[model samples]
Target: MIVAPPDPVVLAGLATTRPGPAGASLLRAGLHARRLLLLKTLLVRVQRHRETVAPAVLRGFEAGWLLLERAERARPDVVRAVLDYPTTGAWLAAALTEPLGPGLDRHLAHLELLAVTAALRAGVEVDLVVDTPGGVLPLPGVGRVESGGAGRLRIDARSRAVRIGGGDGTGSRAVLRRRANGPARTLTGSGPGWRGLRALPGGATRLEDLDPYRLPPDMGIPARAAADHADTDHAGWADRWTAARRLLRGTDRERAIEVGRSVDAVVPLVPRGTRAIGATLSAAPGAVLMTPSAGAADMAETLVHELHHSKLATLHELVPLHRPHPPGRAAPTYRVGWRTDARPVAGVLQGVYAHLALADLWHRAARGSRAPGLPERWRVRSAQRFDHVHDQVVEALAILLESDELTNEGREFARQMRKHLASLSSGRRALA
Candidate 1:
């Protein structure tokens, strides 16, 4: 029988040292776990006929860190086994319940947040490895004990690069690198990746890679025509609108404008959309919604990161629609995501995904402007180093589909995104 999330009894007093093994016993306690495996097989089968979950593009992730956080607490052993060897504190942090106390616990939140935040900040790799023999198991999402495979990740904050081992035994990988410490840096990658495996019976592993420090070809797309549609938040918006309109046109033009709107509307959802772009809920619901924006573009990029929460909400629990927290639990903070203008050389070098892509984009854009290949292009090139800042929403949007944390769309949208991004940023690789 497949084990469900940790028992509240066991969970209330889980060990700090060994969570993985301990969590496995909870599975034995459940009577219908075997049925769940059967259900997974049937559901995956249904996807072959129809679609699985939602399209990855419209959403950012199939699961979010918070959802994973709760599941981990329910099953400590599964987490320990799948996550490799986390520290006692790390495991405790991973097993921590949403604090229903009066206030947010930065210390406890730090552990779980650091696990994911640091992974993204440092570029830790994460992916699924499905095992159909046992049933259909998503990597890191479930453990072998439950018939679903566990996640295999190599986290190195010092190296600033996260490599997902893919719990399903797939070789898919995603990476983020930085060029400096600036806000809104490059986020190069394979774009979105394909779902499940190809028809090898085992499956095809499609990984999107990111090379943040590179620039895509400049296809003479004008950027100034959209000045009329620019958000009137600040002078920077006027400049970026006028500047981008002066440089880009056609598909790039339209995409840029849409991207611009998403980033510019990232005000808090309680306020129901801010100066930033879009706002979507995470598993925690209500308090946190993604808002991706940049100073020049507002908080659109910030909204993108927040939106990831909405996309990955399902992983919060295996059961349906049960709130992850009690009525009084603290909500996931918007601070979980961010954007920057400078490069994140140290972050990537330190192995963090935080603003790593933006950093790489900024550095590359800067270098491209200095290149002798072009004979004094437009003045915009001089400030192009921070171009990634303007596109944070784009990255956020792609993550819903492309990122391992959430696989919302199918391959078709994933491929389209790859082609579009590949065409834009001077041959930068995908986040695949």
Candidate 2:
């Protein structure tokens, strides 16, 4: 028989996964992608639309809770540390698979883990010190907010408490096992063994104190990231496309849908003919990466870039693509390149191609450029044309140098990124 009631907060989450009218309508409004639909219709309630959405997000999470439970049993340490928040349920589900066989992919889980580690540190504190179910814990203050530190989070001022969506600091963590000891690791690396994780400097997660709708333990994201995450072109790339769609009203709707199609189209493209991914692309059939979330034409770039690899695979006749490299310590499930030279800028070149292609789309659609015929206007519009390219360029350059970076050119990149993002920020600026 079962021992406990699966945590009241978690139970409550299960009960409320059904999105009410507002959520359903929002889901209906932005069904561009099924995953996007999940984010919008289901995730928003858990992360953002608390009053109207808590029930639904929780319900979805709860429905998915068994996955978390299994993770606890299998790799308790990994899942506990990685799948710490409700937003992470999807990731948890994805991560649960053995991943060594065919039809196994942990891309979303990998990305989510990277993101949530920062989120946990943010909500808890950089040098956070607090109490936990295990014992006293101390979280080293990430000290400052940077790209790695969750680039200026979006905070909830009214509650006087900081939080990330699905992260309430109050929800119970699905601990598989509590190891006795270890040196210490940050929340990102912290696993079921609380040995290395910190308590952070706040009151306890208050797991028992939460209302049915209140955030569960470990639910809080840091207070520093009070601002929203902007995309390569300064577009408001909130976690979910539903939020993006809400903001993408009026003229942007068609464009947003077009972007969705553009991004989604890549999935089928790569899966079709992936015999040659190594000569040029290096990545494999499942190795292709994408981020049509915000800023830049990342969607098209990957479609084009990886497609280049797919054709490369065909050229070389490499059956299953493989490149064992990623950002984390584990075998690299992902790979990114950095620009060694700022001049003849390779990143800039890519940015140009991406922008020009999207520009072609814009022209073909006959959507007049906003505020054309100006110096800065040209610069900004140009950035939007290849938001993905520019975003990647700046990010790559930053990695390459990694010292007092963000030079004038980098600033220029940021400036244009911000503008293009702003154009999409209101969410009302969809394609023509």
Candidate 3:
């Protein structure tokens, strides 16, 4: 029989990390967490279905459910806490199940997040693995791990290292150091996934191989997108990808990896006129589509922007942040700092949350860059970036606060967001 971990003990780990730059931009993450506990307690009065604990998208995760049931029996409170966060458990399950097309890496990352976070909450070393063609690959989100193959990952949470091989148990195995610094390198084989970050061009792996879904219908269909622009005339794609990687590898590497752990794939689309630099599918949780970027920072910001959409899309599957817009009213849209056109409330929220992430990344990137000789403008620009994006975020939050579409819970979320954003900018004087 699985033994449940005490809630107070697991909860201490949650308290260990607070919201803001220190713990990464899980901005106001605690609000939903606290709200979830309250909601779950109330839901016990009206326990709907066993499926209520999981999202519809995750219904296919039969294997994960088996594992999760074991986890639940062992740590019911921890399981409930992970489920209470709108997307954690669902995303974890969906990742395990291969809910959409490619993105095994994305799925594994979420699984790692679930395992590690649960362990923290449970105050114990938790271990789990995903069944792959080769063997069962470990999922230890906490510590350090290198991922490759069909998203094959080996993370060492404390002393627990992943064993790689077939079910027959005849392949190689390696241990990882969780706190080791510098670039995390993957042991080579098969195609790229998370390890695509470290893979070389013209290798066996192609961008399309890693990100198989070229045109996700949710983002609307487009044409003329290339894998890396290496073979095509679109040198711009190659340049942008290179620069974005440079930024990730150099200054923003650690945090970018932390932020991008949720991203399943980054799909670049051929630019359609002067609109939309990037898009993320609401239906497909981890895929992000991008147009040619203006620069490395722009590309990084775009990833941050679309990742917010990806995250909310996952959470949205579990909870309704706002009531549907009035059926007959013309779809009203609001102005966002990043967009020239007005957007609907949902789009506005996506943009604001995305900007919050962007602002934080830039703030950290400018100050914490390891490489020297970054433009003076970047240091000055950090404050400017924060001001512009924070203003937009505040503006969007105001609308969300005033809208009748928001549920009481939604309003509280917005209130928390507003307060969070305010606290972030509380110390800033007017930028010159």
Candidate 4:
């Protein structure tokens, strides 16, 4: 695959946290292309290390790859849906990073589940056996199936219908349908051992199941027991998300479009009062782990903030924004004014980029009646938020500009960020 460098103009726009429609499209295309390359690399690595991997796992992976390839030829869109899911990239990163051992085999074998999902969605005929050590088959974007016992799970798919049977004669059947004019595929299951996936009210994002590879490795949550408690409150979650989407579209249609494109799923976290909590994993491009307690405005803001992180993460993968810390030497850290602890240069860069967007968000919110039906108190709070985030962004930008750890591209990016912040500051003063 030919990898093209990101356009400098697009990079600059992204640094300002305002990649317009064209820039956003370019970024998404670049990210998708790179992910496809990563998938190919993963397949080759598994093939190279076949001896170390378990025979069953190896066979599963090989069969899955063939099915995936055939599905891609038949329905590239369906295959892309499975491959482009955020957790697929995270799983690939983990599988590639680990050494050749049981851990690696387990990670690599996840590709079989992913491939099966694609085949089912594409309506390709496939009868494949996959190892489900714990009797649970967690399809990446689809729902999970519990076989009631740990052993081999046989999946037979023909014409968009799939039947999953376990060694103990337990079985279930699900029908997959590709939504009209949308890339999302829905699966409805009957009989025992099937838990269908649920989407938020707008159907734009999936409430992701408890897939072990869903979270980054650093989170350290156990796979089988990592089910989210927030799933119980789907009604409330959907209501807030619908409101959040409205608020976002009201605030800025372009930004709302960006968020919609950037995020595919929300891994709901247990609520912590009314405080909003959100996190994005560099490995997982389109997934956000967020609590469900936030109000519409707060949820909207969190989505925007996390979208910046997601964009920057994808950009970093394509272009080196900051150099890694010197080997055997501790990386320098600095206070970015948002977090209590001092952060490394890379962390500071991420903070600066995300806060820059937040500053823009509140700046627009505070300036007159751009957001229709916004309460007076909301405008007042928006002004306060703008002030806080603007200051934090200024402090973080200074750190980024002064750091020697940045690449030439990174320095240029920081300079563009500083210029953009100056523009926003001038606008604030004009409003005053």
Task: Give the number of colliding residue pairs in candidate 4.
Answer: 0
Per residue, candidate 1 scores C-alpha lDDT tens digits across 398-418 of 443433322222223234334
Best-fitting candidate, measured by lDDT? 4
Please provide TM-scores, in order, for all candidate models, with all chains considered together: 0.20, 0.21, 0.50, 0.91
**In order, what lDDT does every prediction score?**
0.28, 0.28, 0.48, 0.77
lDDT of 2 at 17: 22
Candidate 4 on 138-165: residue-level lDDT in tens?
8878777776775777777654456788
* Candidate 2 structure quality by residue, lDDT tens digits, 137-180: 22221111122222122222122123321123332222212222
For candidate 3, the TM-score is 0.50
- Candidate 4 segments whose C-alpha is farther than 4 A from its true place: 1-3, 167-184, 217-231, 272-274, 430-432
Q: Flag regions of model 3 displaced more than 4 Å.
A: 1-206, 209-212, 217-254, 272-276, 326-332, 335-337, 365-373, 430-432
Alpha-carbon shift of residue 347 in model 1 (angstroms): 18
Task: List ranges where model 2 is wrong by over 4 Å.
Answer: 1-86, 89-253, 258-432
In Å, residue 375's CA in model 4 sits off its true spot by 2.2
Task: Report residue 275 deviation for candidate 2 (angstroms).
Answer: 40
True-structure RMSD, every candidate: 23.3, 21.4, 11.1, 2.8
**In terms of lDDT, which candidate is stronger, 3 or 4?**
4
